[model samples]
Target: MLSISSTRQRQPFTVLILICLLLLLPTSLPFLLPPPTTRPSLPTLRSPPRRSPPLPPSSSSSSSSTSLSSSPLDPLLSLSTLASVILIHELGHYLAARTLNIKVSEFSIGFGPKLFSFTRSIINNKMNGEEENIEYSLRVLPIGGYVKFPENYNSSLVMEEELKGREKFKEKLNVEKNEKGILGMFEWLNEEEEGVVKKKVKSGSKPKITTPPKEIEYYTDPNLLQNRRPRDRFIVLSAGVVFNFLLAFILYFGSVLFGPGLLKTEINRGVLVTSEPIPYSPSSGILHKGDVISSFNGVNLLKLPSDVNVIEKEISEIIKTIKSTETGNEIEIGRGSERITIKPSLAVGRSYPTIGVSLSPNFSGVSKIKTRNVFEAVKLSVQEVCKVTKSTTKGLASFFESILPKFGGGGGGGGGSISGPIGVIKLGSDVIGQKDWSALINFAAAISINLGVVNALPLPSLDGGQLGFVVLEKVRREKIEQRTMDDVNAIALFGILILSVGTVFSDTMRLFGK
Candidate 1:
């Protein structure tokens, strides 16, 4: 009956193997057999345009450009990339625990219902009758993941018992030696003394006593995380944050080193003339498309403040100057290599001065921006990561500030806005629609840095919260009550659930334009 049951289990394994083989067979057929004769090509069919023609470049092209650049896999690719980073973050904790000889029970990616799972024995000792297994799993959702260690690792008493047992073994060896005669004592001293004493003894004397070396057995408790030094525990808890920051740095550095392109805006290059001049307006034919305004009136647009903010201020000043002047202003524009001067005529209707041609705020262009060496890339990448971190920190602070009042006594009419999973997906889709590789990479890096920062916030049910507990334990020199910790975590979990649901609701409303 046992054999039959075992065979029944093996049948499923056999079937699985056969299915896998069959699936692989077609893929391997090309290599296994000679190339087949070429088949006749089918007639190609072309699909008609699904949308209207794009507007002229002079008008805002954001919508049309996005439509043209978008790819079907953008959302899926972004989600997968995010999942990969989250997995790395979990791996950091898993590795740290394993390095300290703490047994991790499970390492799982994603949350909720498990889609697939497998277990492997990391350590097995038949003689000692000891085995340690780790289960790895994948789940249906890709929001977050975790690495679980043994729940009860407080093994100080077990260590004490082991020490006492070793001492008892030594005492037993000593007692056994005493039970023997003087010959046994001599044998215990050295092998040479035992042999000499045996030769000295008369024939047929009591057999020389022999005492074998005591076998000192050793055992290791796999559940060591709780019993480990506070420093180790702290490191294990903080490893996830460290790995997340590392991932951000790597992504930023790689993007700068080998990015597809970068968006750049050169100052004093003059605004781009986007359209042909309108008739019955000043400088209708004089200033045409592609003209770069080097100087407006007497002010040189090329020579403005060096600081970015100050430069923007100066540009605003130029616009104000033009609007204030009722008469036409002499504008020196750079057209190719030639510098042409034209005066924009005053508009017939009341308001500001008029220039017939449409002008872009800035002539921004995309250019490759790779570093010459890795060191330079690393330096720049670090700066970029720092900048993004600061911005995200500020944004989160603002978000909390806006939302906190709603739950408090002071009622605010406008509640704070936050992007949930759905919102994030929409935002990611828009970014991917830009079809700029540098933009995509930069966005990913920013998200990674934000994830790191969020995990490091001192809130319950987070890595930082775990670190906070470790710090308290270190300061108090006492283990916090397990029940209290569990209760606190449960409350945190509940709070998170409420927040997630609210965010999801908000995201749904925003998605459906409600």
Candidate 2:
């Protein structure tokens, strides 16, 4: 063996030791450093789509009485609830007229001209000021409401109280106001032969088709509503609007009180820490499917709040805090129930933190009894729906007036908007991404309002429009000839056609993202 200096031998030994240590450093350091702090995996989290609310009781009318039942298929909406909305709306008009001691000539659902009508007068029954004919009619158009008043209504007066300057259900006796409105009834009495006027042989004969023809006179009491006390006439006229408003409110409340107990929401698990580097997102370095996430970032999943508002607000804050923290946020998560700290290292902009999987809500939250307090729930729900409806209406109008125009809304061959089944499904997906339950509720409510408004608009051919003409005659004091009425009806029909085509076209184009 070649002999070397003692110094050279020691140096070679030192170099060999350094290379061995370098080889084992990675494996050794992991054991030396404490694992990213973590907590228990909360497997109980759930998303809204997982829960399905109970369906309403089916309508109980025999034959075709139950509208929704007519169809055997279950649609996106429960047929029962949707049908109930229509029934209740018409009922509002009927009940309101009954309250005021006013007689209804007929009541019908849907719009357009009348297709079927039946009339009847009460004989010897008195219940809550309802003393006369309970007429029920169905019009040709099946999308609206109609009520024939005994006399013209003027809502400016309600001697006791104005219906908040609105027309609502209430009673009024012509009272001592020989004021043209009441006097006209007296004048009506004058026009009839005394004997014919006193003709009371039969019971329950229709008040409208009474006695001998010679004794009666048309417009006998007409004083043009001008001579009546403002309050008196006002109350009578306000009844229609009041009834409609109430019906809408009831529908609003009913949706919440008895609505299905499912929301379209997402199962979002992300780091929620205040002092980490960069924001923690589902696709960030630290967030992973196996890593347990908590409100404290790496600690615990949040316990959902009893109050929806608080839950939303709290979650929002947690997210903001986590995002604002420094990049490479160290989060504590429980993987396989083993608590460990996960350093969600940053990538680009702190957006993608991942363990590699798309998550959905597992229906695992405590099953809540939907709407324990009916009244409170109803009130909240109605407000939510109304707000949604109003906002959506504004958005729709803006979309047509502004957005559409900008994106092909400028008339000629406008890339019209449309949403077919595919588009509608996409809408639901977008909704889940955008907001929580409240937003979903509002979306539902807004759709209902839109349906109501469209049905109620007094456009040509629409039921409301026909009713508008009926109202205009009384308000405008100008009689429309049958020919003129026919012409208006024709034009309105055309308008409806145009609107339908445009709507469908727009929906189709929109689906194409035009």
Cα error, residue 194 of model 1, in Å, equals 74
Model 1, CA-based lDDT:
0.55
Off by over 4 Å in 2: 1-72, 75-84, 98-103, 109-118, 123-379, 402-447, 455-493, 504-514
Assess each prediction's global lDDT (C-alpha) against the native: 0.55, 0.38
Give the per-residue lDDT of model 2 (tens digit) for 109-219: 544456776767775244444346655767553433444444332222322233332222112224322454533333335546433423532343322423321221223
Put down candidate 1 lDDT per residue, 1-514, tens digits, no spaces: 0000111111111111122222322111000000000001111111111222232232322445222366898777766655576677777888888777777777776666799999998554432445778888887665446676665523344446556777765776577568875445455545776687666664546544344423323233534565567899888888887887888788767766765422222323444465678886666767766556656555565555433334434455555555555564565555544677666566667455656665543333233356758899888778766766665665566556656877795432222235554555556666666665555666566666666777677765667776788899999999785445555755764565455555555656877886
Model 1 vs truth, CA RMSD: 23.8
Best-fitting candidate, scored by TM-score: 1
TM-score of 1: 0.54
Best by lDDT: 1
Model 2: per-residue Cα lDDT at residue 96: 46
